[model samples]
Target: MTTLARLDQFARERKRAWAEGTRRAAKIARERLRSACERAGQRLWRTLSRARHERARDLSKRVQHGQRIVKVGREHGMNVAAATVNLTRKAWRRVRGLRRPFVRAGRRVERLGEQYGALREEWAVERDIESLVDGGEPILFGPWTSEVGYEALYWVAFVRWVKMTYRLRTDRLAVMSRGGVSAWYADITPRYLDIFDRVTPEAFAARTAERLVSAGTAKQMDLSAFDAELVESARRELGVERLRVMHPSLMYRLFRQFWLGHRPLGFLQSHTSFARLTMPAREVRIPDLPAEYVAVKFSGAQSLPPTPDHQRMVRRIVGAVAERYPVVLLDTGMAVDEHGDFGIVRTPRIQSVREYLRPSDNLGVQTGVIAGARGFIGTCGSVAWLAPMLGVDTQAVMTDARFLHAHLHAARWVYRTLDAGRFSPLDLGGFARFGLDVAGASELLADRPS
Candidate 1:
């Protein structure tokens, strides 16, 4: 090559190397600074804890004032109530160790991708629940003020039910009490549950399958087809492709046909405007814990696989882990009426422990709703998942056929859906007859064959 070309190449190499070195130095410096700040914060927290202890009586009164917000509007028949849990010393200790570090780590790592960041955030929240209790009395933590926060509370209770209900005759159970609802839930769950699978293109059109054929004027579309139409309409209306992608579901597809189309009487055929249509509330109510209930809720654990078999294995372990701890809490939402009569609030005020920062703003309101129970029962969804991580005993419920691997990974009392569906038979004598033995199932799950 010519001398000029060689000189240019060497100059470019020097510039690139300098830029790379500068970026590396900057990254290392930022990380160190972040760490230093966290250390300082922790030290300050310790100092404040000491100061708060000295003025415990006065501070308790102030806390009570904040707590009183829970009871407001309850008698107004608003169908929503505010509540929180009182964390035990042990529970507080556990949470303090995990929360801040987890958050900081998650924020730093999120540049990698949305899924990884989301998982980290969930993990941090789970850690908050784990660091709160010592296996007995409920650790109260919420000031569930908003609809969204209440939803998170409800999810905790629902997951608790999922875990504890598996071995009803058993003395103890565990559940989740914190974390956000997963998008994976929307993608999964439908394969098995009728509630999810029953949704069809006809339902989207506000017409029954029988009615679709008779009403020849009405257009029908498959899910994918409907998505295409919706995408075009969204692009036309918003002048961008991003808008089409932003709206995740087909709820908007019908919205466009009825509102944006040329038809003036679109409301007459619109799904939402239909006279008989009733959209089910997305979230369920959290049930109240019964006086006789001896339940435990745990959090702070990382979720395992996303496959079916691995999840069932996790559930099997949950049931066994919960055997040692009687009371459990969970973070799972239940579907309840918007009027709020069904879930964990069957009775008057009774204190329970909640263990997380009120992250209602992060997750939508009504993320997790649950109904009240005789005692606390749960499995990992929100709060209960964190419990075992904090060293609580949990009896996790496992199902072999779950779609998302995460749920199965968190299950303890593993149930084989194939066995439940008569694929795995107790006897070969009759093809139509299949017997299920819960104890045997438990035993099989417990046996980790090497």
Candidate 2:
């Protein structure tokens, strides 16, 4: 255990300790690598299994949808086949001279004629017209054509006649309308016809039948056989001895062809008088509305196509307005197919008016909602035409220029025609004037009539 022997033993011990440390480090590294590989394999398997499950579910849904479609198609085909068989049988009967029974049955099934006769008797008993008239002629005014807006316009001629001639007794006047006029039409007519007593189509038809029976002409009369005959009967029953029966189509033609052109003076005077007489106030309601809300109606009979650009523009306008006031989207639920296309997306500030109001609501309720709104925004449709009549401040975004001047003079409202092809600049000047600012003046422009 001299100095040289001690040094050699210590060096050997140090080298042995280093070799043992290296072996332990290698074992630890191998265990760590094995665990990492196992975890990676588990994650890969899970991802593959999840993807497979989703694919299977999607396939099953597609198969079920296909089956439903096929079933519907089969039912529809069966219905068509049944209809074809019935039609074929009728055609065969007609060819084989065996259609007499069907023809006789059809003749006996004149519900309108029978109903008309019954209605006339009921009216005669209820009204006591013979006593009420007291030798004065009772005048019946209508059998008004169905289009509500034009029906309102047609009344102008009668109003003009009353103003000019002063012969027809307003007190003895009764205005007739066909059944099933919309609540809107019913609500609106009072403004113009409140002066005259009203009669329904049933009563008018009944009266006509009574007259025909009295004249000994009702035996085999079919009122629906000829339009001219119907018109003549209406005139005779209504006691329209000399006054001409004017149809809405005739009025429209006259307005387009003559009244708006060379014969403008009389037309202008009459329409101006009509406007003065017919304007009435409307009140609307919004349930749980915020302090400020803007009502918007975009889809209608003349709605522009819901292209991507149009959708973007709508969103931009709605988004811009929503920042200042809650926006209520008013829709009639007519455009179910275009809902996804025209639906406002990404704006939390807009709500559907349909959520609060139903389609079945009366026209008064509908008009009140539009009239009560702080501001109205819509396309050039019935609602747009109505907004101004209700005295609501309105802004109309129009696609067609033809309607720009059609009823512009009827009421006051801001109208803007947009080019559907391009991204027309958002002009917020109108909204700004109304105290609504979505991106300042860059959002909308207040368009003026030319």
Candidate 3:
């Protein structure tokens, strides 16, 4: 070997050894530093562990009644209310997953199961509806087992989608909705079967009570054996041997996710097709109705709770309207649901259609009155949902918005999308709290053609 070659090989070996030692030294230093940090963290954790236990106990006792708390911003100092403390403790107990990890995992599994079940129900309903439409048999749209608002707003719109999507023959479809509201489905079908014709209003009310008792809800979100019986009865009334059914449950199932906050508003838009409804035909007219009358229907229910204050508000509001235009009170003396008629003694200007209403045609009569109204003022549901479709300006009043927010949000959207009548909200709670003048509030109600 050449001398220079030997020298270069030795130099290369020394450089490689130096680099390997440097790497080893760096790795050992890192490991030692990590170990030291771990020890520090352990010491810190131990010190705070006792502190955390005591601090938690301190916090627990601090929020109790009779324990004066430092007031937060924009407030005066005060002791916590006993009820508030109890509610807080109850709320904390409800979050079991916070303390037990497995509880959270179990809850997640349950929620997943619920979602799967809902999806399965939705798919099953879609399949059933498609099958019924495909059978070439007449589709009986309803023994329509829902509120008037839902019927006018969501249910009818959803049915429009069904007709368009399936290319349903108008001749093969008949609506079995109560209240003589065949006019509401003018474009969908001409065959209108009134439930009142087959059954008396008293019998109808009894049947409705049975349905509600069985379902344990005011809304018909599910179709039960009672519903099947009604469908059968309706078919017999139509004198048809075999008729396919399209129940309100279809619309309820389609919009359940949206109502539950799992889906967006667009989900409803995708499923519903809205078209403005023509007025309930002039043939079913209210007798002796003034040309420029304001239709008013106030019920003591969720929106207008049956409180003395609410009653006064109702009277004052009606009085204010009666001054401007002759008032047509759409009051049904019959007991249907939990809601009751807010009894207003009729005057010459303030007249009720109760005398005009039959148990079966009560809602139909109300709808007709509202359709012919120059303007409508009512609790934030029922006929308020209908008046807009009939192109009358609507002023919907509500005290508690807990139940109304979802419907209001959708109603506002539907009104805008369909280019229907103007909808305005009258905050009755605000009026009660802030001493709003009923006369001033009534002044804001929009004017419509007489």
Candidate 4:
């Protein structure tokens, strides 16, 4: 029974107790960790389920909102369509209401036309030289009165010249222009160019007012009424009972289609007719131009201003020509001043005739200036037309082949040669290198009648 044996047994017992405690603690720790992990998993699953439910609810709400919007849009579209249809129906009904009156008016017009058989016969009468001269005072009628200078000079003046060539008395003739005639045209000689500065309706009303006044019904009158009286007085004074009215537009249309479109017909008929017509007497005195200066005209087509490229090419051409002869730039009165739209500054080396010749300058004076030029260069336009008529040796620069063909007579007879053809780009360097043949230009200038 020794104390050491008893102590050994006690130690073994303590070791066993310690081992059991450790085992128990380890088991408890493992159980706690397992429980915590299970709780965490449950919480995660609940959170995930809530999130999924929220997303589903949000998606459903969005889909419902979209459906509601689509329904509203469809309703709105239907309403707009219904409103449009109703409006269209109302307009159609209104139009139908107006159709009867228009039909009646048309019938009345046709009846009136039928009644005026003699007038139709007279209108159908072909204008011969004898008829034009002895028929009576020639009356020129134009739909557009406010024509550009070139149009007035070429078309209007040409028609007037044609009438004059037939020996029509200029003093007795009356020109009826609808809308106000341009000042450039109004300044032309013979004093028979009467511009009906008002519309046809106004003119008719004025004439009625005049008749009423003459019948002693009205004592006082307005300006328009006075104009009518003046017109009537002039007609009586000129001893013109009925004027042989010439429709310039109709003539021009026919000229373009039949006269200009057909090759030899235009040259033989229109051009030859124009040649036979003597130039109208000009009241405006033309200033003397430079003795040997080259005349250059640069302008664009109707309503369109010359492009920068065009101006630059013209400048280059002028410069090259100026090297040989003094260059004079002729303003067509439709010249567009480039307000430095292009970055390059173009200072024309040649002298501008614009300072001398104004927009209001007489067309005769303008023509005279063109005629006096030694060598003429111009764009394919009215000026080019005039050069041929004047027998001036010229070079015409055309942008389009159609335009050149349309004015074949001018292209052939007017210009000595074509400067640039259709589709020729306005390259300054190219033009500078391909300078105008100095000798050819000189020959043209020398050959031109002073």
Candidate 5:
């Protein structure tokens, strides 16, 4: 019997024996941590913002410098993501490999078998152990947590750790065990191995905003908006002619489907302060979403406000861009539900071409779904964030002025407009021009001393 299996059996027997206050003990621990984080965050914020009226440039320069250095390092193959993946994989393998005589629920001792028969067929016992150690065991956290707040914190740390260290996002493994959707194997990266040790709630929030918000003006920008300099910079470096793109869609279905195989633990603890603290952290990653994505007006009796002509206008603009580019996807995720209804139906223009896909199909399968798109277009949604992380040139068009300042980083372009009530199609030529700008900036920056 493997040592781990033996230990697991022992532990399970112990749990069954005590079976009384185990859950209560865990709850108490969670509540304490939540309160601690909240109080700490408030204290930190008061201290950090006490400075004199400093120009935003000071902060931008420092942040941008750090981001750029990280990017450059990745280009040279210094991967924090790979390391994290390896570390977690290693830890997990050990946990899964020890053979043990499992005490069955019916009271008989049976040889505990591999969780996955397929894996057993392919790998010898030792080889399987190696895989687990290298890849770490995925701990599916959903069937929503009993403690939603703590779940949120865990997710925040997990996502940030991966992004910061590996420059890659976590690939969620979905499961269908608990209720509707849940995570099966949520991998932790090295970047986040000791996150709780280094982060307080305030720092976590700041870093989150820094990661999720796009770079530009202090206020949020609409999806169509762009920072001329940022685009020009990317264009100059990558060569304008070579960069191609399609309209942007958030690929909501792809992500939802990816999580389908996972579990969602119900709220595990009850702490209002903890909930409040993690909400902002989650919000930072969510980005300043558009009203249409946020709206869920249905057809016929379910309809409301006619989708504000502006939303349709936005679609038309996206359609125009898609026609000119290799691929264009509209992020209609705000209206998405488990049933696949996105409230607003696609316009004839968008439906006819047949390139539109749910986000899950495009991103999770690990094949050539989005591999070919040269550029990405959208509001500051996950797809936009992900495209740049994957190294695609993206122009995140934000209709809301507030989004421009929202801390979205790594995209090749950013565009916004002042007209809030109206939806104006971002000029395809404008985005093309922006790409040129980005390329140019890249060249200039490249020549500078490292």
Candidate 6:
């Protein structure tokens, strides 16, 4: 109300307005300069196409080399890998039509008093759970429309946390997921709703491809139309008018900060429980293999990408394992996701159980085989995470681990914390050093890439 206070407020307003006007002017000037440079650069690039192409090729080779370095070590390049998080994101923005995919989520959290943006996300997660708790209807815990590895590693563990945090009984729960992974949820619930029961495999696969194209990432963050249909189908099957759903998006949002390095591992530790995965009952009829065959399910995607050299490495490793024990390849025999199987090696003592696998029970059959196996060897990002919890010694293979560094870091700690099976990762360059004390170790080392 005083004249001096009013004068001070007016001066502050004038200074803020001047600062805004200066920022706008600077932005316009920079935009004009960038436009002029782009026009000039286009002409120059066309004239020196060969040089530009060579420069791009050099950068590509460097990226490939760095990918190999990440592949060989068990998260050896974590510091460098984490450093590239922002750089890689900017690179993605630079790519044609990638600005949308790389854009930050539309979450408005500035008012939530976030210490590293935790409060808002944690609040959102709790709100979702609160809805499920408030609803007296039967709660559906999935239609787990994501990778099996994520289902086993993160989704199931998150559900366990919810159950423990709320003290909910299994009788009120039902899980919806693909393949007959009912056994994975046996501890949590007896009711397992199969997505395959509602949608055909061909239709499910096509819809999933469309969903990925829309979301711009493999993790299912949004509820797609197909996802809604699956939920509706489950309701119809159960003869329920309404169903309370706990979707995978909650799990994705909760721990995403830790993955992005905005939050520490303790944040995830406080939110989710990382208990070891219990073996699913092997009631499904699996292939009659040797009493103690090694289960192998390597795919040429994500971690162990498909390349001629990588395929050769897979053959050599599988051949070495076969020399000691019979090998059972856990190929799904169909395109389940973006991952492509490493194909069957024609080497002696190797058998693929792909034929016996049905869409309805493919995951169940695989679980049964893996739980019964003496050990497991596969791609680092897939069952490697699950196999450790399955109580089977796992030799996870990967030619490049650029995208799996954080996941690998978490897996190491979880396995150690749970006192589960020994998880050993074999990198692209470490093939020569793998299983050196075991039978046929010399052959594996001798044939490794020099």
Winner by lDDT between candidate 5 and candidate 2: 2
Candidate number with the higher lDDT (1 or 4): 4
List, residue by residue over 1-450, the lDDT tens digit for candidate 4: 799999999999998996898689669857865775576567556655665665566556656755665577577775777656765665566445544544554565464444344323323333333344454454543322322323432455555555556555555445543222333233233444333323343454455455455754321212234444445555564566764444444344334433335434433244222331123323225344456666666666532236665556555555556666666665534322111111222234466555454433434445655555565766555455555445455565544544345445443432333221111112122333576433443344333423
Tell me the alpha-carbon RMSD of every candidate.
30.7, 39.2, 20.2, 42.1, 29.1, 19.8
Off by over 4 Å in 1: 1-20, 23-377, 404-434, 439-450
Superior candidate under TM-score, 2 versus 4: 4
Off by over 4 Å in 2: 1-247, 258-266, 275-286, 300-305, 335-348, 355-362, 409-442, 445-450
Best by TM-score: 3
Writing each residue's lDDT as its tens digit, candidate 6 over 319-366 gives 777777788899876886888888866555888888888888888888
lDDT of 2 by residue, 315-385 (tens): 66667677666776765443212122256643467776555443233233455565556667765544555
Ranked by lDDT from best down, the candidates are 3, 6, 4, 2, 1, 5
- State each model's CA lDDT, in order: 0.31, 0.45, 0.76, 0.46, 0.30, 0.73
Residues 233-296 of candidate 1 have per-residue lDDT tens digits of 4344334333212111122222222223322332312221111111122233324433233342
The window of 10 residues in a row where model 3 has the poorest summed lDDT is 65-74
Model 5, stretches more than 4 Å misplaced? 1-138, 143-309, 326-368, 403-406, 409-450
Q: Which RMSD does model 5 reach against the true structure?
A: 29.1
Q: State every prediction's TM-score relative to the real structure.
A: 0.20, 0.41, 0.73, 0.44, 0.27, 0.70
Which ranges in model 4 have alpha carbons more than 4 Å from their true place? 1-138, 141-167, 174-244, 259-272, 276-289, 302-305, 332-349, 410-450
Best by lDDT: 3
